[model samples]
Target: MNITAIKDKYERPILSLRITVTNRCNENCLYCHHDGMITSEDEMNADEIYRICKIAKNIGVQKIRLSGGEPLLRKDIVEIVNKIASLNFKDISITSNGTLLEKYAKDLKDAGLNRVNISLDTLNPETYKKITTKNLANSAKRGVLKAIEVGLYPVKINMVLMKGINENEVKDMFEFCKKNRIILQLIELMNSENCDDEKFSKEYHYNLDSISEKLLNICDDVKTRDFMQNRKKYFIDGGEIEIVKPIDNSDFCANCTRLRITPDGKIKPCLLRNDNLVELISYIRKNESDEKLKEIFIKGINKREPYTI
Candidate 1:
């Protein structure tokens, strides 16, 4: 496997691509960043996304994660997954709210998705309804279990800890993941300019540093990822727990290894700062050659900088 490496100014190779499939979502989660976007209607079709992924693979990107307000909201999501699967990336995954997974889990697995990360804040149905403004917690739970049964190895659960919200459910979530063989990731609430609830983010910003100690104490073994903003992984019982604390952390920025593509087809370099994005929707729509498109990918890589440092 001969892979071309794209390095940033800090020598961090761009190995993962988080593509925002669409801005449209089924639920209205209060803490949603919408992929650092305020509002958008522009969404790339399956063909456009395939071309982008091909260009990305040619430049040494090995991992691809499909994200959205809800990625499965796209009717042609199966086709999109099939197209990207043809690229032969080492890993392919999707992050969703999990409301629709039960319907599409088997199809997605057959289409070459390697894993899945479902966003679930709390186990309490009332709290879930309050946070997401939707009573789909039971539906989401069924989706997670179905994803596991359908062979989506390491069915990860992403839980964003909020002070007055789901912070108290950390231990409970860990136990749930262990019983169900899910990977529980504790994420810190992100404060992005794109977020509409600035006061809510400020009031509920609970750092993961304070909770990591408790996790470490309960875990049996520790594992680590060379990539990812949250690199620490603790093995507990039959499940795994990872901590993601990316807000205002120089260490996180220094270890970061990702490039983002918005639903509108712009190559975003950093999630925290939107100024350095390289517009590519026009070029993509113009049907530019792969060589030309590769230039834009490199340009996006060159624009990468340590947002915290």
Candidate 2:
């Protein structure tokens, strides 16, 4: 396999592949972005998904993160993970709502999942229900604990900061993560078509810029993963905090090394815009050669542009 890194027009290396396995989710979070995927019943089967990942690995994509409205909604999730694991990518992770994780954490770990990022916006069960219309906060917590017990190292909790909502839980969440020995990621809400509406995003989107001072005060040693999504990490009293800025920021696009694949097997070059996706499902259905698929991947990489610009 003569693998070479695929660089976009802006010269950014494509090293990460974020695949939305399915749009079917168990919880309906008001702020869910659906990973910029168009929700439909046209999801790729496990074999189709594995083939894509195999082709991806052949072309220098190092990290693969399985995401969805909720990836666990797919019953064959473990088989999907095992197939991807066979590729031996540098890192293979999943972003899940964690409701069903308690039952599948061990299976996922055994299937070669490196880490997990579970969405836990508010620790309060009532508030969680209000935000997601699901009262599974206790289940999510147990899933996190189970993931840790099963050796899913560095279990990360993703909390979306929303104004007049869960914003006040920063300190409490930090404390909770510190006690639990897990990583806490504070994500700034993004305005995507998958969101409830423009009104809801505008009303709830809280800028992390306002709380930078408070974050710095809590942690002195700040580390920035500049080339890898511009994520900032801070460590305080053995607890780690990562701040994920909004994608609308040009800096986020400028440093992005990732590309996305929607559940239906379309190549989404940019998350903020839906105009440039290269279709792959039809070609795969036609039993296209791996080389032909590789060309499509290259074409998709070429189509990538900074959406914020």
Candidate 3:
């Protein structure tokens, strides 16, 4: 995190960090949920996140995101966000399912949250029920609206578009984004270790090339949101849409800038790959010097390898 000589093997400097706060999600979207996890839900408490955020801010990690099974599910999220905000962070955001956001958006905003991203893959009620095994369409929709109401400008909707599923909503999502001034992010479904089960079918491949072609037709423009570099903010157009292709094995994986921290205190260097982590107490108790902690951050950064086809 320190900007000095802390360069990855590829020489890329780390900046943005994504932190997951909880593991218990309300809805288990069939495809994305995994069977393997320490379900006990044991991790750092509010005080721990506060201390970590303080350490992160001291070093040069300005942007921190709260993620999880659904960060809002944690009753202490508001306090956590408030504490993180009280740090030296330049941006504080949270990723949630939106089912619980409607009830907490105002409180979250009051806690110094700058933005929020909700996981909403389908708009059709039937498809939603089929996908999530629950009828949360109304409440989820309300959550998005509530986020918008609180001036969470450019409220982002993280839509994991899959073929034969919610892919057709591409155009509809852009139209919705244009009208509501929301940022609709059409992200390709990832190929995880557990992706091949009944949940992830071949019909869901959804080649980015084809999807982008069709999306360009609907979107007035599509912009790639760069991490770390702030050359551009939200991509603006008659219809602003962002396309994020999956990167399990892609050429530019070496430059992947974002880091994810799972709810149970497991820090994933990259979403596609399982790697090293920072055990909170162990790391602190070791009396690890600032430079060594920066090394831990850099070790993950250096692990970044080139992606293959």
Q: Estimate TM-scores for all models.
A: 0.96, 0.96, 0.86
Name the better of 1 and 3 by TM-score.
1
Could you tell me which residue pairs clash in candidate 3?
Answer: none
Runs in model 2 deviating more than 4 A are none
Tens digits of per-residue lDDT for model 2, 8-86: 8899988989999989888988887778777878999999999999889988999899999889989999999999999
Task: Give a tens-digit lDDT track for model 3, residues 1-309.
Answer: 344424456665556778767767888786664322234367567877776666566556768888777778888888998988887577888888899988999998988999988888878889888878889988998999999999776588888877788877877776677778787776766666644644464667566567666656654554544552221123445555666666653424655566655555555665555545444445745666766655565556656555554
Give the CA lDDT, 0 to 100, for residue 164 in model 2.
Answer: 93
**Count of backbone clashes, every candidate in sequence:** 0, 0, 0
Reference-based lDDT, residue 120, model 1: 96
**Segments of candidate 3 deviating more than 4 angstroms:** 1-5, 33-40, 197-201, 217-222, 228-237, 249-252, 285-295, 307-309
Q: 1 or 3, which is superior by lDDT?
A: 1
